[model samples]
Target: MRAMTYDTYGGVEVLSETRIPVPKVGPGEVLVRVRCASVNPVDWKIMAGGLDGLMDVVYPVVPGWDVAGTVEYVGIDTPEFTAGDEVVAYARKDYVHGGTFAEFVTVPVRALAPKPASLTWQQAAGLPLAGLTAYQLLTRLDTGKEDTVLVHGAAGGVGSLGVQIARALGARVIGTASARNHDRLRELGCEPVEYGDGLAERVRALAPDGVTVVADFVGGVLDTTRAVLAEGGRHASIADHTVLGAGGQWMWVRPVGADLAELGRLADAGQLTVTVAKTFPLAELAAAFDLSREGHTAGKIVLEV
Candidate 1:
């Protein structure tokens, strides 16, 4: 099997395409013939050693978490799937272990879910990790039609789906994005608020009572978000905010298969969409990582296997 991997944590340049033996399925696991894999900021973060404190991946680790693939083999204990089932999953490879960046990967059967029928492998590849994050955060708040929620970074991978999911849940959605995506946000049923230059004020002009919940995928300068939230509002962020004040709840998201299943259902129903902004072949994994880290991608970047 061919894979792009790094022997040590460093910059993208450390990544190299090498011939490695394909992973094998163990008990309760399935071997997947990868069709596509999603590139996420965490992939770059781990590659650059940003998460060394939390993950102990051995040297020469592959770096991807989201996969949309076909089951090529099944482990003895994995009865739920056969050798030809299509699946999409958050494979938990960011920290250590093999990942979807290769021609094949072995993932726990519990982590895999049937890919949405409405999506190609390329689109479904973008959904597992980011979609699950959005699902868990929104559902945690129990937000309803009566509530108004603000989604920061509304045009990025997770935020894009978050906006749609909020609307599907009947919340009044206000999204912060660059003016370029204003129409796109509106299409997702969110009133677009241009970020920066009095972002809170802009949101206030849209919702006089203030946003009752906020999902901040972006970091820093969240005092404005605090002001936008009504008292007792909830805020969820993927980024670390050491100085965030206590006006509302703050949390970090963890991957949940149940949440990804729900997201997959939404996609299958044509109620959600995964936008793939860019794609690269497995050989160009380094460029894919660079694109994801640039912070301006319109949607998820993918690695086609």
Candidate 2:
């Protein structure tokens, strides 16, 4: 199997392409023939040791969590899927190693979902981590039709999906982005607000009473979240742990097959969509990391295997 691996934690320079043995499938796992894998900020962050204290690392690590691929072989006892099944997964394991950024990767059945027929491989690849992040956050907040929800960093990968998911749940969505992305947010059924100076006022202009739910996708917006939340509102942050101090949930997306399958159903029903900002070949993992690190792309950065 061809994979992008790093022997030690460092910058993008630590990543290099090499041929390694095909990972052995264990019971309750499946070996997927990789088609496309999406890049998340956490990919590079993990590569650079940002998660050193949170997750154990193994050397020669293959770094990626989002996968869209075909099941080539299913391990014993894994009866949920079989050969030739098209699937997508948030393929993170308990340890940092043997990931989706390769020709082949083994995924536990717990994280795998059938791919939606409406999406291309690249789009499906982009769905798992970002889509799950938004879905789980909104779910935890118990969003509903009567609520006016505000999304921070609404044009980026996770926020884009957050806006759509909030709308699908029947909530009125106000999304924060740059002026250039406001129109895009509107297309996703969100009222767009420009983020920056007076962000609170802009959001308040749309939801005069206050937003019933706040989801912060980009960090450093605790103040803005505080400014516009309704008196009994719920809030959460994927980027900022300080949210915990503010009566908000600090979340890390979990790989639940049922949740991913629900997202697949949303895509198939035309209630959800993924934006692909750019695609790179598997060998260009480092370059992809650079683009993701730039933090300017509005959609997902994917690698076509």
lDDT of 1 by residue, 217-248 (tens): 77675787778888777776666454245544
Point out where model 2 deviates above 4 Å.
Answer: none
Judged by whole-model lDDT over C-alpha atoms, candidate 1 comes out at 0.84
- In order, the Cα lDDT scores of the candidates are 0.84, 0.95
Candidate 1 regions with alpha-carbon error over 4 angstroms:
93-95, 243-252
Against the true structure, whose TM-score is highest?
Answer: 2
- C-alpha lDDT (0 to 100) for residue 17 of candidate 2: 96
Candidate 2: tens digits of C-alpha lDDT, residues 81-161: 999999999999999988999999999999999999999999999999999999999999999999999999999999999
- Candidate 2, run of 10 with poorest lDDT: 194-203
lDDT of 2: 0.95
Candidate 2 residue 136 C-alpha distance from true site, Å: 0.4
For the record, the alpha-carbon RMSD of candidate 1 to the native fold, in angstroms, is: 1.6
Worst 10 residues of 1 by lDDT: 240-249
